[model samples]
Target: MSLSVSAVPPLLPAASYEYRTVRPVHHGHMGEPRTDVLAAEEPLEISLVYGPEEARRRRTLAVTMRTPGDDAALAAGFLLTEGIIQHKAELRAVVPCPDVTKAEERGNVIRAELVPGIVFDEARLERHFYTSSSCGVCGKTSIEAVQAASCPVLPAPAPLLPAALVHELPQRLRAAQAVFDQTGGLHAAALFRPAGELLLTCEDVGRHNAVDKLVGHALLRDWLPLHALVLLVSGRASFELVQKAAVAGLPVLAAVGAPSSLAVQAAEQFGLTLLGFVRDNRFNIYTHPERITG
Candidate 1:
């Protein structure tokens, strides 16, 4: 039987109503001033639960203030992106707080169980807390520090990305941004063809989670080695995002915003090309410019 999940509320923004004044419509012509409803952003908290026993022993791992929907997927994707849990086998399950009888009283917390062989340590868990899209991984102050925990490098393949396809990406991305249109409070990550064909896109209050969901979807499909395609993010590039892209074997990572110094370093070290400021008809290539051509 399924456990109740009242705590899992709406994860995305929904329209709300408010009063507003309209243009000159003479009091009698259009009646009184108009009022309308508009959607606003929703904030959600992502927590972790773990214990050796069944009762009196659940601890919160990390709380990600995020959009509420996709809670299960968010937790799973976070673990994957953070390199917390490797393969699906390493996870027994990703579920809502089991204390259903009093979920409302306890707040919205989720539990992710690791397989017997996979144990989470305090130091390993500490890394997750330090994460933020702006500036995380402070201790990885040097290049060598990044490589020590890096995933295997993926080789580059000359992909045949058609210019015509690239032109269609932004529109497709816009169509899928249901939440962004409402709240305008989130970032998006999309995977598309090297030739510019769109594949999938995900949006979230947090830029990192959006990318994680995009990459996690690919991971679930065993579609790593994304040499034939490219990744585009709606915001600035960060080292954490770069790390997730590398782990997924995505050869090129492009963002519509600026690139952080650490992101450039991580991309170069992992054999991935990083691009930023991907707007208008131009983009800045941080590394491996060979991938783009006239």
Candidate 2:
């Protein structure tokens, strides 16, 4: 159904940093207490606002726990990957909710205004919007439900990447992890060219959130359908990570850790090049091995 929203509030600045203090005990001895910088983990309520200014409607599409920063991209990437919005042009503006009275709620809520005549799928959102940091979907009757909502990832025409280039990606990803370096507590996702050039990197308390932020950044730049890029994650390859890569049209997904059974299955089904244990200049190709050049 087409929804309408009247006035969109000004956009809120992205919050990428948060702090917490902790005491350290090491090697059977008590260490001095210190403040640590951490990736900000907060709930961002994504609302879909559309229609004319005179008559408006707003629906809370999702409330995801993400590391705050690139929130507009996060929300846009979430909608794109969820099959809610197809392209960036469908988005009019993303604004923080002005109705919130609390100070903490200032940047936690954002409304994405869709262009006129675009239909907002309320039922689809109702089925899949309440996502946590660890899981994206909860109630699914069958695999088809999940499959139906997935974005299509087409195979790359030239399916070969140098093994040496692949080996260098994890290091580049690590180099870009500013948050992880300080806190040593955030997961990261990065995009790279086939030749190992790092394009973008994002860190979050949640692995999937990192991927979402990366994909959302790409979405804002009109860089969807990432067929020529390789995606590297700092953690294990989960089904959700694979799904986000698939939605973004990334052909190669490499992880520093192992891949789950479902993750391998999704990669197989979607023609993704899935790699795991991607460290020490060695990695295992779980699916679509043709994409990796030795």
Candidate 3:
């Protein structure tokens, strides 16, 4: 479903960026096309407000590059995945930075302020080191730290209908990708019920953020214990994406592309039913195959 946001001023001045791609023209042939389109990435600063003062205790948290919608959920999901704030109640609100220029005017920065009595574990966040759209686990303090903090997969009986649902996810996800159809430059993540209904779907320039938005939406709607839903992505499964799915209590994850070894390992450790190359009528089961049924 398309999200409707109240009219706001332009997040960035009108500007265009050039995007290039090569496409197959015919059998054994390819061609490069130079194209230009309006740039979409914008900085969203998240700030937290806490306290009996309720008016005070304002602080800047993280700046992110996003498509300028679902700011609140994006902030919440980022905080949850980063292990910043433990629960949704800790986050009072998310708003644009008052001093955007003072913070960072780039298209990839946002501020998040927190509520009082809700002290974030700066140590953990620093340890995680906010990752960008293109890289995950790049700036972490230690591999062991991630492994140590890594959550073990939930051990539940694999679903009897999981495999068939996994196979159906890619086409469902593609059918729901309205934003991607328009931009052709975005990634998507979706949550599907065991019976094949889409609970929520979100798209973004970054795959991680897309998943975050979906999780954040679930959190806002108080849909914890995500075991009943299967999480699907439009690209290769990454470690961070898998981590987000696990954190949200999703037992199964399916991707239309390859699964990075680290991601597969994470899924195995977390006991998440992992499927990759989920196109056509077949899919590759990486970790748990028992959950999928005929």
Candidate 4:
């Protein structure tokens, strides 16, 4: 049941950005025509299959509007952070759904098949979720519905990261974002070691999707309980992003922009180190500052 990254079934690749012809206008005059690199926004339908081996059932989990790359990771990360599946061992395979009418859109739908013998209530699917490229997951209906069951109160931050190292991470993350550099239209999530090494990075139109992709990427490689790493996001830290990081056992969540009031509250509740305004050689640690030194 322990599958290495090479042994795991691969998800089909898709374009993260695309080119389109557009007219550039400077001041009041229309400038020359140019090809613009725009982040590709497409809906990814995530489906789940689980049941007894003899009788399997398929259910649609969520349809997320995201940049087209890392579709499988998005699904797997979504499932893990959502507490639907705990680890990669629960997943039998992740592949693009081939039962689509449009050949081009085949890459837009991904399927995560769970190993048989997992028990979950089918009625829980009754609460429909509305996901967007900007807002992450929505329509949870209540606080209980929105809360992730996996996040435990993380212990004190140990082997603390240097404040100087945290300051330079935004640049390192920016350097790794190839699609964002081209389109200037994608959000990113990255992991870093205490020594400031960039471990992994993922970019997507949806900020939440980017984090999900990170979770998926790590989950497939059996990197759960990511207690030793720090997570950095390209945008503001939202409660949803904080929840995802906490569930993945990341001790610190830093954002280039501000943290919402709700995000701060959630971080406090989950015993996570919430940081914001992590740019211009400065950053703010909102909670649990024991993890950062100097």
Candidate 5:
């Protein structure tokens, strides 16, 4: 039997939503004001600390505008997907950076301290200039640069499942998305077992950040190389999302929306199963259709 997880994970920030008063319009007429919930969007600075114990080095890695929760996971996911650190052992600890000059900025910063003596790649840091909530690859120089990154070859003859099993994933993912239900504005990523058991889900204003948060959680739980499971996204599948899934070694990726051209190419290149428009009992298999049975 699967165990229930009630406690929160470590390093997760508080509520991901906020309440605001707004006037609603009914039949082009202004209605009474009411409190509305909105997805909280804020800047999270992911920084890294490395080097020897006596004299460690630190630097801001990337800044992302995301819903304020599951931050440590976001940092971890970004590092692994960006090919910075390969595994969870590379991370010593993920904590809030308290050295900020502004008190308001204190908890908004996350510092990932790398295990001492690990090789640090300074060049990889140069490729990413900035990441926005809407686009994760905003700072990447080119799609070629992203595709060129090393990825493990997925095993041949991927797992197969009934079409009905895959069709239910979007609904399952939607049910797990507590934040999106409240704000109706956040994007989400979810993981499931090959047998269709839901594992974890996360939400963020940025589609990429949601994927990263799920990755980070898996990393901390030693669930890397998610080779036997499927990944689902609440929005369109982008090339960067495919790259992130490949880096994490996921076998199948399903989207409730469409897939970009580059995303299809990346899925084919990485040997991953890509599914799009997975809703209403129908879906499109962009790559490796052998993985989805009748």
Candidate 6:
């Protein structure tokens, strides 16, 4: 499903709309019922708008089930991690598709306009981009298939972080998760300086989307090649999370949960410092421990 080009609407702030309602839940032994706030989950259709100004084209890239906040950053980050755009300058603008008349559809369809002269690879589009909430790169057939979609992440030369600083990150990351605090049902991704200060944080129902939002925020701010900072995820590290961090040139990735076997492999292959089970003042470094100092 593609959309035709029209007058671009003013960029709206990314927002998370309520998709679920709270109901009273009665416990077996409790007299009073409790109410719960669930994280909103909805489909966001990401589309690509590119070509010469006179002869432009649009294509629906992917439909992802994500929490609605930071939709633009999610789209931009998706492209950046997919190797569709190497730098922030490649993107002209990310706006809600104006052709959709329904108010509900307005923010759900995002159009990523490319800078003039950059070619859009339709073949690559056919191979990658479509994803689900559980898996971001479901189209990849093999390990090489995944590696082909992204450039190798180079090793960091400076800004070595202390091991103690690394352990302190999860607490800082947890403190910044406002949405998760309310719902207790969202995943978070945070960017941190080597000295242990939080740079930015994003949350979503999908762990991958959270990472994408964080990467997209950095991309929009011209902060690519994030070699001097660490990326921390609130859930167990997966292959897709590692891939996104690697594409953004993030040198260190720490997770509060364990990492999958393939995630560890990807981190080792990309020379990224992958930490797992980072809680209670302890963490296990799965790869590239050299980047973490005493």
Question: Quick one: best TM-score, which candidate?
Answer: 5
TM-score of each: 0.75, 0.86, 0.76, 0.89, 0.90, 0.86
Off by over 4 Å in 3: 1-39, 48-60, 99-113, 129-152
Q: Over the stretch 195-290, how does candidate 6's per-residue lDDT look in tens digits?
A: 887878888889999999888888877777887888999999987788889888889999999998878887888788899999898999899888
Better of 1 and 3 by lDDT: 3
In candidate 5, stretches whose alpha carbon ends up further than 4 angstroms from where it belongs are: 1-14, 129-144
| Candidate 2 C-alpha lDDT tens digits along 1-294 | 111222121122335566778888899888888897766678989988876666667888878887777677778888787778778898888777788888988889988898877876567756773343356443332234446775574665844799888888888888877767766878888887787767778777778777887888788777777888889999999877887888888898999999987788778887889999999989999998888777
**Candidate 1 runs further than 4 Å off:** 1-58, 100-107, 129-146, 158-168, 225-228
| Evaluation by lDDT, superior candidate among 2 and 3 | 2
What does the lDDT come to for candidate 6? 0.80
Residue range 37-127, candidate 3, lDDT tens digits: 4226766666555545544654555556666566667877877766665567776665555555653454334455565677655455433
Measure candidate 5: CA RMSD.
3.6
- Candidate 1 lDDT over 1-294, as tens digits, reads 111222121234232212345544675575655543333234334455544444323455666655555556667777776666667667667777656465442435667776555555546565643344446446355334434444547586546444344445556676677666655666788877675656777777678878776765655455655566688888899887888787676888888889888889778877888878777756777887677664
1 versus 6: better lDDT goes to: 6
Locate the minimum summed-lDDT window of 10 residues in model 2: 1-10
Candidate closer to the true structure by TM-score (higher is better), 5 or 6: 5
lDDT of 3 at 163: 62
RMSD values, in order shown? 6.9, 6.4, 6.2, 4.1, 3.6, 6.6
Cα lDDT of model 4 by residue, 1-294, tens digit = 222333222222447667899999989899989999988898999999999999999999888899887787889999988778887889999999989898767788898999999876566566532233255543332223445355567776445889999899999999888777788998888888789878888888889999999989889888787888889999999878888898898899999999987778778878889989999999999988888898
Clashes of 5: 0
Model 2: which residue pairs collide? 4-50, 4-51, 4-57, 5-50, 161-293
Model 1 residue 117 lDDT? 51
Q: How many residue pairs clash in each candidate?
A: 11, 5, 19, 0, 0, 0
Worst 10 residues of 4 by lDDT: 1-10
